[model samples]
Target: MSQHTFLTLDEVASNLKVTRQTVSKYIQAKELNAVKINKSYRITIKDFENFVNSNSTSQEPSISYLRKTKNCTLQYSDKSDDFEVVHGIFHGELRSLSNNGKLTPNKFIFGDNYFVMKKLLETHRGKVDLIYIDPPFGTGQDFNSIDEHPAYSDKLVDGEFLEFIRKRLFLIRELMSDSGSIYLHIDKKIGHYVKIVMDEVFGYQNFINDITRIKCNPKNFARNAYGNYSDMILYYAKHRDNQIWNDIRESMSEEKRKELFPKNHSKLGYYTTNPIHAPGKTLNGDTGLEWKGLKPPKGRHWRYSREVLDELDEQGLIEWSGNGNPRKIVLAKEHKGFKIQDVWEFKDKGLSYVEYPTQKNHDMLERIIRNSSHYNSIVLDCFAGSGSTLRVADKLGRQWIGIDNSTHSLNVIQKSFKEDNINFELLEYVPLD
Candidate 1:
C-alpha cells in the first residue's frame, strides 16, 4: 500500500480548476471524502482520487464551460483560457547575475514580470505570502525621472492592456500561498476593469477591499470633473478569511483625541465618561440591589458587578453627576488605536523629490506589509518600479523578491539598496535563443 498524503481545499481547488467553494460544496454533499483538521478541511489523496474517478463521466463540463457558467466574468478579445494560461510554457530561464557572498533568500529579477514570474513558479509556487504590484496604469504615456531619463512605458490600453494584466494575474495566483494576498495599485480610470479581472482570477468571494488611496493634494485643474487626486488599490486574498491579517490599527490624531476626550484632569490627563448602567435588568443578581443607598434604575442593570462598581468608585474611576447619576471614566492614555478603514491618505511626493517616477509612499507600503505578511514570509513585487515595496519589506524584516526589466529601475534599486546596505542576489531572465 502507498503512503497517503492529504491536500488542502485550495490544493484540491487548484487541481480541479475550480473555486475552493466548489470543492467545499462537494465535501458538504458527501461527494468528496474530507476530514476536519485544525478548523480546516483536509482530503486524503486516495479519497480525492476515488472521488474524481467515480465522478468521471463522458459529459463532464470543461474548464471553459465552467468559466462561462461563472455568475460574472469579464469577456474580452484574446482572453486566454485559465488552463492554458496556468500551464503555458514560456521559453526562458533565470540566470544568476550576482551573488552577495552571503546566504539570502531575497532576489531582484531583471526581466519582464510575466516571464520572470513564470520561471519563479518552479520553486516559489504557492509559497509567496504577500504581493504588491504598482503596474502600469494604461495611460499610454512614457514616464521619466527628474533628469528627463526614460523610466518606463504604459502604452498598452483597452483590451490589449486587460489581457496583459489578466495573463499575469493567473501567474500571480499560482505564486500565492493559500493564505497569501495581493494589493494592485492602479489609476482609477482602468481600476474598475482590473477589478473584474481580479474577480475572475481570485474569485469574487475572495475580493477584500477596493481601497481608495488619496495619493495627492486636490488639484484645481480646468476640467469638466472633480480633481482626480486619488487612485485605487484592489486588495484580494488567495483564500477568503484565511489570509494573514495582523489587523494593524492607526493611532488617534491629537485633534481627534481632544475632541473625543474633552474633560481634562490635572492629575489623570484627558478622559471621557460613559453611562455606568446598561440596558438589561439583572433580576436575581447583586446588580439589582443598591450599593450607595440608590435602587436599580427601571429596566436597567449595573454595567459591572456590584463589587466591581464599588472597586471602580473607590479608585476614583467613576464620575457622579449633581443629580446622582454615575458614569465610568475612561482615560485617553488607555485608549486602543482606531481600526483602519478602506480609505487611506498617504500622498506621494513630486518627481524631484523621488529617485524613480511614481515612487509610492513608504508609510502606505509599510501598512500593507505589516498587515498582510509575517517576518519570515516572502513578499513579492513583480512590477517593482522603484523597489519601494522591497525596501519597506526589508525594513519590516521580511524576505522580498522584486522583478523589473527597465535599466533605469534596476539602476535606481541598486543604488538605493546599496545605500541602505540591503543585500540580495540578482538574477536576469534569459531566453534560450
Candidate 2:
C-alpha cells in the first residue's frame, strides 16, 4: 500500500546496469527495497530515491520469486493449427459460434450453451490468446427466470459448480496456446477446490500465478478472514518457453538513462553490450563453433563457433563490451511507461459496473493480453457477461469472439457498449420466428 511510485524490474535492472536477476537478488538481500509480485518485481521510487540520495547503488537481486519451472504431465501432439476442443458428451448447438469471431458481444445470453463450449471452441481452434472468467461464485441458484437477466447465478451447488467449470475448462484448454494462458476469477467457497481441479486440467507445471482480487469497496461485513476483500485469479500458462511477452517500457528520467549508458548514441540510449569471442576459436556452451577474429570471455566458454561469431559480428546484433566477458548491449529506448505488475489495481470504466457482477478491471485484462496475446490475435470469452473483454479487445485493437446465452445478459452487455460508444463488428442475432 505504501508504493506510491513504482519501477519495474527491467527498468531497475537497466538503470543499475545489471541483469534483472541481479536486481531481484538485491531486493531479496534487503540491499534494495522493493515490492515483489508472484513472479515479477517492482521498486518504489521513494525507497530507491532515498537509497540513491545516500550513495552509489548496485545491489544483487535475490533468486527467490523466480517462477517455479517444473515440468508437467504434458506431451506435444499435433492436432491442427487450431485448438483441440473436446466435444461435449451431452450436447446441443445454439447461436454457438455466431458471436465468436464474427460479432462484438454486448451481454450474456440466457441459454444453456455451456454444453456447447467444446464444439464451439473447435470452430476458432487455436485462436484465443487469453481467457478470463468470473463465473458465478456465490451460493445461489442458476435459473432461467424472466427479467433475472444474465441467466446464471452463484446458487449452484459445489458439485454442480465443479462440473460447470470442468466442462468449460476442457473446451477452454483446447482453445489456448500451449504458450497461452487462462485466468479464472472465483470466490473462496470454491476457490480451493477449483485450484486443484485447474492443476489437474492445465497441469501443475503450467500454473502461473494465483492472485486474490478484492471486489468489494465498502466493507459491509465483519469478523471474517481478512474480510471478503478479494477473490482469486488462478493462472496457468500453456507453455513456459515461447509464451509471448514483451518489455513494457516507461519514460526514464533523462538523468537515469544518461548515467547508465554513457556516450551511447543509439536511440535506445547509453546501453551496455556483450563481446564476441576471439577469432580462430570456438565458443563453448552452445555449438562450440569457432569464430575467426573475436576472442571469447576469459574462463567462460563461447556459445557459438568461430564461424558463427564472425557472422554475428557482421550482422551487428553483437555489440562488444570492453571487458573479456562481453556485456551484450541490451538495446534501450527512451521509455514512456514501464510494464505493469502482476498485482493490478481496479480501474472503473463504464464497463466495470456493467461488465459482470464479477467483471474485473480492464487494465488487468490488458496486462494479461499484453503479455500473452499478439496484435490481431483473437480472444474468446465464453462467459462474456458485460463484454469487458470484448470492449477491451476493441480498445486494444485486437479481434475478439464473445459467447453468452442469456437474453438479459446479452441485452445488458450490448446496451452498455452501445452507450459507451464502443465500436464492434455487429453480427445479426436472429430471433425465434
Candidate 3:
C-alpha cells in the first residue's frame, strides 16, 4: 500500500465534486475525519477514502477520482530571469553616519534595495520581525516635490513592474522570520496583479488581508468613471497563525460613544442597559432557574447563573423595571473599543505640506506598527520613500532598517531623522561586477 497523503479542504472539495462548505459540514458532523492545523483544516487521504466508501454505493475505486492537486501560481515570460541575475561575493561596506551608542543602530541605506537586501541576508536572514513597503505603483510616471524637484521615477509598468516587485519579494521572504509579516501598499490600478504575485511568493494559505485605504477625499473627475480615492495594502504572514498580531482595536469616536451610551449615571458615568435574558433556552441548567420571584421569558434563559444574578443585584449592577424585569447595566468606561476592520481612511497630506511626494500618514503607520510589531522587533522598509515607516517604528521602540536608491529620498530621510535626533548608520551599495 502506498503512503497516504494529506489534502486541503479545497483539494477534497475538488475530488468530491462538492463545495468546501459541504466538506466542512462533514467535518463538523463527524462524518469525515479531519484535523485542524493552525487556522485551517487538513484531511488525510485515508479519511477521504473512508468518507467516499461510506457515502457512495457505486463500485468505483475511490483512488480513481482523487487527482493530485496542482498548486496555483502566476506565470509570465522572464519571471524566472530575476533568480538568474547573479552578483559578486563582495559584501557592501557600511559606514556609520551617526550612532546613538545603542546596542544595535538602526540602518538607513542609500542604495538599490535589491542589492541592499542581499547584503542584509548575509547577517539578518530570518531575523526581521516585520516589513512594510510602499513601492512605486507602476504608473510609468515620475514623482516630484512641490517645488518641481525630481523625487523618483516609476517607469517600470506591466510585466516589468511585476517582475521588479516579485524579485524583491523573493529576497524579502528570505529575510523574514517564521513569525514575521509583510504589508505591501500599492494603488488599485495594478494591485490585483500584485496580489497574485504575492500569493505565488507567499503560499496562498498564508495570505491574510487586502486592506482598502482611503487615500484622499472624494474627487470630481472629468472622466465618466467614479472618483478614485483609495488604494490597497496586501498583508501576508511568513506562516499563518504564527505571526505577531496585537489585535489593536480602533477607539470609538466621541459621537459614537455618546450614541451607544446615552444614559449617564450620577456616580458611575455613562452606561447602557441590556436584557438579563438571552435568546437560547437552557434545558436543565441553573441559568433556566428563576431569580427573585422572576422567571426568564418564554424560550429564553438568563444570561448568567442565578447566583451571579443575585450577586449583581446585591452590588446594584442590575436595574429592575416597573414591570419587575431585571436588566444588566454595562458601563461605557469598561468597554474595550471596536475591532479594527479591513477598510481604513487615512488621507494623505497635500504635496505642499509634505517634504516628499506621496508621503503616508504617520498615524496610519503608527497603527500598523503597534498592531503588527513589538518593542525591539526588527522592522524593514526597502522602498523607504519618505521613511514614514521608519519614523513610526523608531517612535514605537522597534529597531528599523530603511533602503532607498533615490537621492531625494535619502536626503529627506537624513534631514528628517536629524531634526528628530534619531541616530542611524547610513550605508551605500556598490555592486562588484
Best by TM-score: 1
Computed on alpha carbons, the lDDT of every model, listed in order, comes to: 0.87, 0.58, 0.84
Q: Which stretches of candidate 3 lie over 4 Å from their true place?
A: 1-72, 81-91, 98-104
What digit string (tens of lDDT, one per residue) describes model 2 on residues 267-361? 44566554443334333345343344434444545655555665666766466555533334545453345554455446344333343454567
The superposed Cα distance between candidate 3 and the true structure at residue 298, in angstroms, equals: 2.2
lDDT of 3: 0.84
RMSD of each: 8.1, 19.2, 9.1
**Looking at candidate 3, what is the lDDT of residue 219?**
97
lDDT of 1 by residue, 76-105 (tens): 678665556676787889998886687789
Worst 10 residues of 3 by lDDT: 80-89
Candidate 1 residue-wise lDDT at 229: 94
Model 1 score (lDDT): 0.87
